[model samples]
Target chain A: MSESLQVNTMADLMAQGKKPEVLFWVGCAGSFDDRAKKITRAFVKILNNVGVNFAILGTEESCTGDPAKRAGNEFLFQMQAMSNIQVLNGYEVKKIVTTCPHCFNTLKNEYPGLGGNYEVMHHSQFLQKLMEEGKLKIEGGEFKGKKISFHDPCYLGRANGEYEAPRNLLQELDAELVELKRCKTQGLCCGAGGAQMFKEAEPGKKEINIERMEDVEEAKPDIVAVGCPFCMTMMTDGVKTKEKEDSIKVYDLAELIAESNKL
Target chain B: MGISNIFFIIALAAAGFWFAKNLNKIIRNINLGKDIDRGDSKAERWKKMFMVAIGQSKMVKKPISGALHIAVYVGFVIINIEMLEIVIDGIFGTHRVLAEPLGSFYNILIGSFEILAFLVLISCLIFLIRRNVLKVKRFGFREMLGWPKTDANIILIVEIMLMSAFLKMNAADYVLQQRGVEHYIQAGAFPISGSLIVPLYESFSTGFLIFVERVSWWFHIIGVLLFLNYLPYSKHFHIILAFPNVFFSKLDPKGKFTNMEAVTKEVKLMFDPEADPYAAPAEPEGPVERFGAKDVQDLTWKQLMDAYSCTECGRCTEQCPAAQTGKLLSPRKIMMDTRDRLEEVGKNIAKHGADHSDGKSLLGDYILEEELWACTTCNACTEACPVMIDPLSIIMDMRRSLIMEDSKAPAEITNMLNNIENNGAPWQFSQTDRANWVNEG
Candidate 1:
């Protein structure tokens, strides 16, 4: 197998040479699920190829409490946030990064309020940086003829403004990057944030996720490129509902990068 | 007694005149803490006011308020001609050649407005109380109370007086006919003269019927004109401005402002990923302090005018989650402040020796910063303003100033922004696994 064919886990990542002073906080979205283990490992390896040598600061990781805050449970939100902040501050970590938009949103947008201010960057942004620096080498132009569409996570796009990095990386992969009108600033919420991710969505005329997923259908792509893990999960469910699960694929931006290696 | 009667008549007449005039002046004052930066021309103000105020356009949205307001507005306008007869009869005697058509039409309108104005007034009072009273009954009223309560209240009194005038005129006719002297003065210089003032008219006559009619006429006519002239100065001003505000409403989509004055980082980044994220954002920027309205004066003149224009309808407060759930938010207060400020400023400006030669004015202290920040930018208040005052815009600019420049906001929200700058998510997540959600979730 090619050296790049094999991926490394967070344990292996630290065992390898570390270049930067940072701790990667694995969010509940990743820590809680096993499939997330697969995509995250892929992202970790992609990060290595990209020159990020930070150790996983998983020990200090805690829920950002955005879900509680947005759920109108202010007290619970404060409790969760304060505890997370104490641990993060105790680890004395200065910078952070994450894949879950919820974690990203809370850490970057919600946590600093609780006194855990740290430099946060989405994994997509970090990877896009690697691609630009020629650290994450690409091999396959095979998907050149295939069509792809990018699903912008609501927090990272409309909320935080990290809309383009993932799509630019995709375009470099030589896939036809189709655009959706509701893609960026006007990006529709996946009905998963503001704690909607955990609780039953307050009933409305139509489900927000369903509304967003329908917007995705119009792009008519062979694959839907996504950045945040929640978006991948949500859009995957959307793809299943439309029963286009097989024909249409949801690839995390990192997964796309890994798949692009053409090994 | 007749001497005292004349004095009674003059005193009521003088007070009514003063009240109406002062109302015009007062409605033009009350600072709303917005920035109505004399940017638009008189023509623009007139254009907005004409289409919005004179047009009675906004009310059309609330099928009930709009339809009722339209009827009341039309009735009020037609009642304008009706007032001409009352004033002429009060100051002099007889309604002149104009009284012929007005007499019959006034009766016809009694039924329309007697029923309609009463409903609008009662409904509006329910709203007025809803905004301040803090109750549940306000729920059913669609929260209609507002500064226009001034208009509606006056309208109610006017309707009652106008209705009474119709009733009194007919009752006098009844008294005169019963006394057997319809031929003596039906169209004479004294429509309700000596013989017409029989025992029935006498008891009521001893009271200031003429004086009351005169006061009511002044209230009706003066209220209409001053309200008209002050149309751009108040919240019910929307009852006038709504048509225009709606017509010019940012038809693009909900949640987008009218103008996209500059490119965002996404565009800049697309063009040059090397660009700094802190670069200035586009839209109404050069002299403007923030993206959202920084203060009351920051509001468009139409919005400043919307305070006066607001009918005091509490729909905005009713639908507002923060307000509904007991947060210290009231859309009516914001709208009222605009008119209130203008009225106050108008008084100061019109004061005998005030100093505003440079016109470098602040909206003063009408809206509290706390009030400004309390807004959730939910747009419900704007949606319910009846006049289309878009209070959210005023608030957003203030937020922009506080957040972008002053770095001010609730410590919680600011902390979130700090979390954003520090952590990839609002949590203390591992940066390496930002993509972990893809694999795990």
Candidate 2:
């Protein structure tokens, strides 16, 4: 997992007197969680491969305060959000692409009201745009005809009403896209929304992730695809819980694209 | 005017007084919430009201229930025109006063009303069957177990009765008109009811026909008045509140959330490097209260209005991923609990003064933290609501209160917050290692 790449930070870019086309918001999970870090690397590799000029905030990048906001700590959330906003404003950043739906949702929806307005895109949307521009070429490779089920992250699907970009990008892999019983607007949460990823499951008859995984299992795909880091964690955990980790695999959409393109 | 007319006037006054008093109490209770300015884009607001409430646009998303609801809605509105004539006749003791003035137009109006009344009756009966007989899944949730189910049934039955009484009165009036009674003039059309119901009374005498007509008229008018007063107590209040709720709905993109202005201001002050040491600070908004809502009073007036306007149709709960996946959170229950808490607070204020606390709040006393934490903040509830009642906003506020005021978040979340605070992210990993995953080839 340890690989060296020329990732420029905002501070580095500012010092060099250069501006990237887009700011890559590597969210907390994508920054640290072992599995999510892979998504970050894959997304970054794709950006690097496509010759897209993108810079990370590096040590300056902080949590978007999405979990704090959703968990009811407005003070903490604002503290985090404003700190990041000041940094972005200092850099005069205009566009941001992130691999985490939580960050994507907060930066896109919750930030404008706080005077931090920018064009925020989820990595799936960004990847789709790259493909449309013919910058990111794909040859399907090993993913051709593979049975894959795409899980819609709650923030990406219902919150933002974006059910197409991720799916459209997945279709570019030339794989058999099997849909879960509950997909799109009716997509089930992987039980990590509303800061639930950071909290212990409340008393319930069954964990929400397990229930969501039931929908995934019903689709019976070789690969469970996710566009959000939180969904990746939950789905992977669900696969582990079901003891089907050896048979069923979970991959972020960026990971699949990067793997297929051998980028 | 005779003694009976005076009696009718007194009844009308009493009903009006009761309805107005209750409405005032509702307004006062809703005003208990903090003020928010929903005064922007008046034109857009009016358009939303027309499309969502008047046009029944959102309701039609689910075809069967939507169509039936539109029938009851259209019937209730159109029949009120005839109600105006009834009010005039009741006070002045004039029979069909609009009939003479409206002429053939009055006949067409009456015909439409009669048809609408029949439609209302049919729709209500179907709704009743759906609730009680067929037992629709959305309508039979645990939240709808007791009074809610009964309340829904009662409203349906009452509507059926009201429509029946209206048609019966019209039919009996037609029968008396046929008998050439002096007061029962041959005016207005009752195409369906008169043809169907008049024959049942034709064997009766003029005196009997007159008595039937008078009883049915009284029943219909009194029933309507009772229904008017009942609006505030029942879910059927949507009939009145849906318009305002839709009109005042958030006009921005559905995904956008309102940031706390106070927090934003504080953030700006913190970020500003050019601060003067001797400058007097701006006057704070009442000593900087708790960050998020803890009770009904902490919510915005629109949020409180949302509680009042919820029809409890369960479309929100039906679509909620958390609820569907057997989680504790039900968006419909959130709205209902807010309304219940608001009512409790209202009652406490009515009993004691406005500042009196009942030693309880919406948090522990009504809505539980478990339910609050169970929500995914997916906005499915907001999208599914026919009246644009945003249950997610209420849940988020309450969660805010819990975390900020009470510091009662789950242990795991507390750790995550600490991680975010210390590491600048929601993980224990150091920030320096964030970009270590990248490979140089």
Candidate 3:
């Protein structure tokens, strides 16, 4: 838990006559899912430690309507997208960073068409940029030789074609990076995309996450690194299905970085 | 004019009539979809057509198959030059009509046609081997088992036969010229086929050689006419529809989904505090329509065009994460089902009146809800399609119908939607507790 950190909101920052370099869109999963909240804290810790001024939409932030849109509720999606766009336009937000690929994808890709344009970057991309600028120093420590296999969230990998930033950030941890047979453009989904995270999977031979978990098992890594909160939930559930939760671990890229640096 | 000329003209008229009737039926079926404005960006649309459909730019993404496809495609177009001359000769009782005035240039054109026919034969052979012998995984998917597989093989065999007929005609004609036969003028050149088939024809009498040439010539022209009419019934319709499909493809940034204009209006009303309260309510556009597509008629005309244009190469399904991970969803199937349903609706309209309702639709009966839910909305299907057929658009439209029209989302999804409505997010937490993670250090 990040008890000592004083997180600023866009409203608070504006009231203080200050503006952040980027607005952190803490998605629903990041803000409320118990497991994903750890990822949120870890990402914030990195931002604070690196001295990058960022603020969240905080109480004003809502779902980007990704699930709603994917689930086919155009009315709900518009209602949600327009609300966020209004708040963003009110603050004149020019840049955004989020830990969840769903929010990152919707805000970066979907928002522009709805007149909510912003320079959106996933936290992994933002972290890589920080590392390139020599602003964030990473000590690999315990994770130096550990095997880590990254599970590319569909929105980040296939949808956006961003296969390198997260991997590049992981390389900073000095971990033994392993490639899953199906990776990058060929990566399997964690079965939580297209608003699947909010629904029980329909009848099928086997659950998709379980099928994806087989790829993780084949990689045989110590850590199953993920970028999206939805992926975090699905992969975590997958590991539980394999009964390997005790030996294998599911982590966000930021969490791994935070752990390595002993933050 | 000779009696042969009269028969040839009658045959040409019959083929033309058959082709026109089928073409009209296809147009009527595609027009059954709701109208959408794809007329914007004329310049950009032309560029897309030229680049994607004409240049086969997207096809070249996978080099081996791409190269073979281009060979067949280029051959199909280039060989049509000979068809034009045949058409002119068939009606006017003139043999090699362009050859006399054009002379050496006509020889050059025939030489190129011979070379292209050979290429077409070879390309079709290789495509057959890839589809049947090599058994490419994409081609052998579950949905491709019946007519799709048969359709692919049939088109390839027809191409091979057409190319063979062309070469055989050239061969016999070359022998006739060697014999200095009257009415068999040495006009057009057959560079490759002439040399290759000369030995086989040398043993035949002049009359027999003329008979072979005549039969092959008639078969070649009639085969082409048959192929044209068959286009409406086969996935090979891409030969005609791909150009227009590429031209009218969604040109926005690929990741952007279309926002509902009706929803956009409602959102604007909610956002504006100064909105007129006493103003006349917006006029209802006829009857209230469902948000997304449930039947073929609910889709946009371009989407219907996309269905017609699908090559069924299964590249989209091959790239689909859901299909790879053992889900029921196949993007290729989505396009196929849409085409099938559209055909059904078209047939129904043809049998009954235009206003007839069969009570069947694209959704549930053809495409299952389970399959629609499996898509990750990853756009992999759209990205992988060589001709820009967007299965995701159809999938999303169906999903919209399921959710907005029927309110029949999965229970968990309903719960999440409820959370979003009540908590402003997709979880049970209050908006005030959204930043609680900041205090957890």
Candidate 4:
């Protein structure tokens, strides 16, 4: 867990030769079952390319337990929290970094209660810092594709107060980006959080994510990269659901970074 | 029923009815929101009740109406206790309890309440005139349609009726005070009614005066109680729920929404080998797969309770842009439907959960496709809710269950979900343009 949060490289894991100083907890969206896995893989590859030497741990990844808590099922959430903590601790892993904002927020915020506490950083913060320190170099590869815009996931933007790191990382990648009328702190939910990502809404008018994705579509951007798995899925689904599948694209910020690298 | 006996029985029936109503309110409010049902301390909950439900803080957009309404609220509560003195006098045959400090000051206290009612009446009239006659502009950021002026009208009628009834009782009291009927207590009201009959009452014979005074006693005490009891069954239930809601308003009002878990991990396996359950956990090997709220009973108990707590003040519908913009959404209807659905579902659940939950996804067309998705998750409903009932969370949860578990979402969301699976974002542009938004040259 600490490895995912980038809190510390614990002593037990230190004896291993060539252990990366920080372990990046690429969440489910960055791993499997998420359409944005390629984008997420790009982020990890960029770090690897930059000599950041980060170890990626998968299968050991647990749901951040945030979904359960938000659904008002505190007990299940606690169980999930403990389950994830035990997995992280078992690895004796310390210092964590993550691509998924929901995972970042939950690890930084919710894990303390279950006693699996560590300093956690979003991949944006980690990657952005790496760039700032000249540790991650960008060679400015030829940029191709439509004008792009970034959708801030509410979990990353609001819940954890992370609006700039992702943007900064994107900036390092040298991509021309457009700002949506609603972004950053005032960013709307992708209709994927608060456990809405899992349940059907009370019937009304429209899917919340679709409503948000429409706003992005109106920006006329060809892509809408987001920081949360739920946002990526919801917005991706929103694009297809709106029949905009051919024109627009969604990517994890990490994947965007990796693509911008000498891939 | 003889003349006096008829009035006496009416008084009895009215008192009984009044009590029955408040009792029902207490029961109804018991179920409105998730937090309230969490057994939070009364001190914590009472704050919300005091500020929102009792205070009607959300209704204050119109200073004119809000202030008058506040006055009426205070007057109704304070004056009712004083009215008890009058009722006791009616039963005891004594015009004044003022043998001591309380009774000594009774007339002065009673007079102020009497006058306050009139002030409330005037303010109420002004409100009515604005909405009905002048058509006072709507409150909030949006305009509401088919807005029932009936809520104001009903409250106005109740207030007017109660005050008129009180005034008639006053008339009887003044008459009796002049006659000095110290022990007139039948409805236990004659002493006060005795005052009503005296002075102005002398115009009539003692027999006629007595009969007329008895009639006023029936209307005054019974009227207030009936209004009290009738509260829960009507929109007026907010009268009670608002008190707790306002006081316990979300500590972080600015926080518009909460985050759900990252994946389905029934265990503490942040490092589990296979920890990716996208939406709903792959249902613990076939537990209940709740795609959405199938019935009102499927809602959190607090949601089921919001029906009774809703004051129907139209604050929610008023603030909702969708409702104003001609979408088929009404925050009011949501509350009512949840209640209706609850009633429908509860009857079945009461029979048996397993029996009732057969072959139906909770998200099945009971709630509309549009209403669920149309909500911006803006917390307008949350902020607008006087009782702190978090309906948005409920709406979102239902959606998540449907989309993630049942894979049943609007065509648009489903399409978007597919895109998310394929791409990391919602747009279909080349993977190359993803970061262009931040580096605009």
Candidate 5:
């Protein structure tokens, strides 16, 4: 699988005088975090299977500075944003897709002010579009008739008003989709946003992620599907803490789709 | 004019003057914050104001509370039309002056007012039960325990009294009209008062009925005036400010964090080769601008107005992930603290001129660093605020001042910022290793 997976860089494609359809923005979590890497691989596999022309920025990419901005380091955020914008503009990138909502949000909403403008889509939206066009057919395989609950990522759902795309793809899996008691606009955060992922949570009666998992617990699903990497890490940690990792599993939307399609 | 008419004029004048004075003070306090341009997109702002503030679109999201609130709100606004007749009659020493002109429309107006007044009375009773008897958790949060709790109960009780007095006055007037008494003309319909309550007042003496009508009329008018003056001190100020506050709401997508143009310029300068590194920077013309809000004065006028517009409904806090998880952060407390501190700053300015130092700031004096840090920036608070009060923006701006100005942040956050500065990510992984996952299968 590794040998046959074709990955091209923007620099390589530029040297070859070719342009890809969309740039796959593997955000920091997708790039280096071991767990999130599998999500990136799953999304990439689906793109390849669907015959989508996409390229990666590879080493030329940098963080979109979402964490820095949310953590209130405006100076650092602007520096990183400007540098990323410079590289992105130099490559003449137009359309972007990412497995992380933070990257998608920052690139789509926050970057235009710093002069980085591109059509950015989360992997959920991209996959939903492919499914809409009839290019991607998910057979549901292992997830057929299984109860799957989606934890809405704050950035993706509340921040960006995107609640349907991921669920639309989930419906394609032929699964029993149960909604958490607090879902959509009232969706709870997984405790990893606002740069909380890099820092220990402030003293509280309970960790936020654990509290959020209580909603997942109540839903009692066989699988918890998520769209963001930060939510992936938090929800997975929550499953482990409840010792329900055996009974209930957490998978990104892309991984679920890729597995269903046997990508 | 009769003696009563002269007295009514004096009372109205005094209440109007007092309310105007307080309103002027609030405007000054809000203007103490830095100027911001929310004047763009007039059409969109009007649409939002109409939908959220007038139409009560966001209030109806919770169904039960939404329905009860709409009843009270619509009752309060629509019934005020009757106040116009009351005012005209009181000023000119006339009785039911609009009755002759409005004709059948006046009957319909009074009938609707009677119905709305009844609904308002019931809604107030339910709101009181929810607050005091049931003790809804949102109304019981720590920040809501003091004057906030009393203020909420006070408004509900006041509304109940005002509506009761209105119906009682109408009942006495109806009985007087049936008796064909002087100046008590058969003018308007009073369904609730005439049918249900007029029986209670039927047997009293003609003089006692007149006494009841006069006393009820005066009480209702004076109570409304007092409530008008009370708006400045109570969270009920949302009644007046919600319109403009929603009109000035941030129209951008919730994920779009505002960019710091000052930081952008400095970064652009760093990347420019022709720029002189040794040259002294140009001084700003006005007072040196702070990087982010350190106090209310550093915030924008719209943010300050948001504090004034907050109804203290605790919807934001109820939906807050941090507050739900028992973290120190409560979004309601942020808006309350901002308003409290702004009031304190306002008093200092009023007493000792604008240059006086209060030896206090909103950041450390009111809001703790832990509360700001506890925020997930998930925007549930902003989404839940019925009046569009954005508590998250204040939290973020204060965080900005803490980090950028004071360089004070959690050790982990400092490390994360350092990592992003050096390694192009929030962790220590080298940039070169970013794409290693591509071949790691």
Candidate 6:
């Protein structure tokens, strides 16, 4: 599925004096986590099908230092951020799109303070923009009339004030988009933000993701769509914990859209 | 001037002096925190202050509570305008001084105040029931025990008494005026008091009605003065600080954790090739700067003000994922603890000198490491705060102190931080393998 993919490195594109319209920042999770990597491929497939000009930083990209920053290690966060800024500025990158909300948040909001300014968008926003521009066409396909629920990523929804793009994209897929009880500004966390993804949750009556899954069960959607890799991991685990993985599915927004487009 | 007039002056003077002294101490306690400039945006701040504080905009997010609260809040503020007349009447030994000059306008003002006071009384009764009988989930959290619970009830009870006294005073005055008694002018309208309450006083003697009017008037004024003095000690302090707290709210995106400039300088120095490695430091080293907050004194002044401004409404804790799912980290508790610790520190300083130590700090003594680690940093608490308090920032600051200063973090967090430093990502994968997903078949 992935071998025939055509991807350009920022270095290669710069060598040819050709700049892509956007830099696809494949974040740490999108690059390394096997499950998130598929979401990355799915988004890339849609991008390729639409023929939107985009390039990846490939090995030149490192962690955006989001986890370290969130975990209260400002020294390490700045070290990573300063290096990334140097590399980004060297490329004269003007725009960025990422599948990860953490990367999108860090690069878009936290980077400018450290002198790495760019127009950054989450892939859902980017895809929604492409649809708005009449460049990308999505048919209902398998998603027609299917009950889908979107788990809002904290960084995307509350953190960045973006609650529309992913939902708009889902609407384009012709899915019966239902909302979880706590959504938008009141959305529950997947228990994976603030570096909690890499650690066990503190002792509690229930895991945060389990609590979120209860909301999902109340909505009773056939599939849970997530815009964040952390949310994806937690929701997938949540579905497993409920022992309903076979009956219910959790898919990233890009993956769902890609399947709908048959990319 | 008469003896009662002098006594009223003495009461007013004493209340004003104590209130001023307490306000000065509060200012000093808040200033003990590190300063940050939230003065960058003046126009935007004023707009927010008017909208959120003056307009009570955000409170309306929860319709029932919001409407009830606005009734009480508006009643309290609007009724206080009557205090001006009360002071003049008490000091000059006059009755309704604005009555003759303002004419029927005074009637409209008093009539509206009477209606508002009735609403306020009703709202306070309902709030008491919500807190005690129905046990609203937010108000019943573990942190709302003891004084916190009693503080809310006391304020409501006090407000109920104050409004009742106001209506009774109007009702008695109306009855005396109807009887054409000496010095009881028919000045202001009393829609609620005159219609509902005056009948109860109608059968009383004119002399007895005069006694009721005088006693009610004195009680109302003294209650208002006592409430004023009580502001600094109670979470009711929010009534005054909410304006400034909302005005200085974080204007940036909620996700943007502040970039530490001190860390940036050090990182820049490390990366600078042209700089001398062995050069003497440019500035003489001052007291070692703590990386993040260990106590209220280490927090920003705005944060300390946030502590003061918290209504202990539990709105933040209600929205917190950890608290909702039974984690020890109640965002409301965080603010309450900060305020409680600040008060302790302020008292210690008052007893001893400015540098006095309480032998306890906000972090270990008040806020537990377990609670600090429980936050997901989702900003729901900040979003849910009607006055825009950022308890998440305080949690993050304390987390920073725990990790960077004390090197005391959950083992998993230490591992995660180490991985990010060593392997670029917050996992053990090599940086060389970052692009391996591209060619995976």
Best by DockQ: 5
Q: In terms of TM-score, how similar is model 1 to the real structure?
A: 0.46
The digit string of per-residue lDDT tens for model 1 on B324-405 reads: 4344446666665555555555665787444453343222255555555444333446545545566655554444445444
lDDT of 2 by residue, A90-166 (tens): 99999999998889989998888777999999999998999899898877857886899999888888778899999
Error of 6 at A178 (Å): 1.2
**Winner by lDDT between candidate 4 and candidate 1:** 4
All models, DockQ values? 0.04, 0.56, 0.56, 0.06, 0.86, 0.82
Task: Please report how far candidate 6 places residue B58 from its true position, in Å.
Answer: 1.4
Model 3 C-alpha lDDT per residue in residues A1-263, reported as the tens digit of each score:
33466579999999999999899999988888889999999898888888888899999999999888988988888889988999999999999999998898889888887799999999989999998899988887678778999998888887787999999988888889999878887677788888887777776678888888999899899999999988888899999999998878999999999888887
Residue ranges of candidate 2 with Cα displaced over 4 Å:
A1-6, A137-149, A171-181, A217-224, A240-249, A259-262, B265-288
- lDDT, model 5, position A157: 93
Candidate 5's residue-wise lDDT over B314-430, tens digit each?
Answer: 999999889998899999999999999999999998899989997899999999999999999999999999999999999999999999999999999999999999999999999
lDDT of 2 at A99: 93
Task: Provide the TM-score of chain B versus the true chain B for each model in turn.
Answer: 0.59, 0.95, 0.96, 0.74, 0.99, 0.98
True contacts kept of each: 0.01, 0.66, 0.70, 0.03, 0.87, 0.82
How do the residues A1-263 of candidate 6 rate in per-residue lDDT, one tens digit apiece?
53467789999999999999899999999999999999998998989899989999988899999988888888889999999999999999999999999999999999999999999999999999999999988887688868999999999999999999999999988889899999988899999999889888888899999999999999999999999998999999999999988778999989998898777
DockQ of 4: 0.06
Judging by TM-score, tell me the better candidate of 2 and 5: 5
Task: Please report the interface RMSD of model 1 to 1 decimal.
Answer: 11.5
lDDT tens readout by residue for model 5, A1-263: 54357889999999999999999999999999999999999988888888999999999999889999999999999889988988988989999999999999999999999898899999899888888899999888578779999999999999999999999999989999999999999999999999999999998899998999899989999999999999999999998998998889999999998888877
The lDDT of each candidate is: 0.55, 0.87, 0.88, 0.59, 0.93, 0.92
- What is the Cα-based lDDT of residue A85 in candidate 3? 96
Question: Which residue ranges in model 6 land beyond 4 Å of their true spot?
Answer: A1-3, B280-285
True contacts kept of 6: 0.82
Candidate 1 off by > 4 Å: A1-263, B1-74, B84-159, B173-252, B258-294, B341-374, B419-435
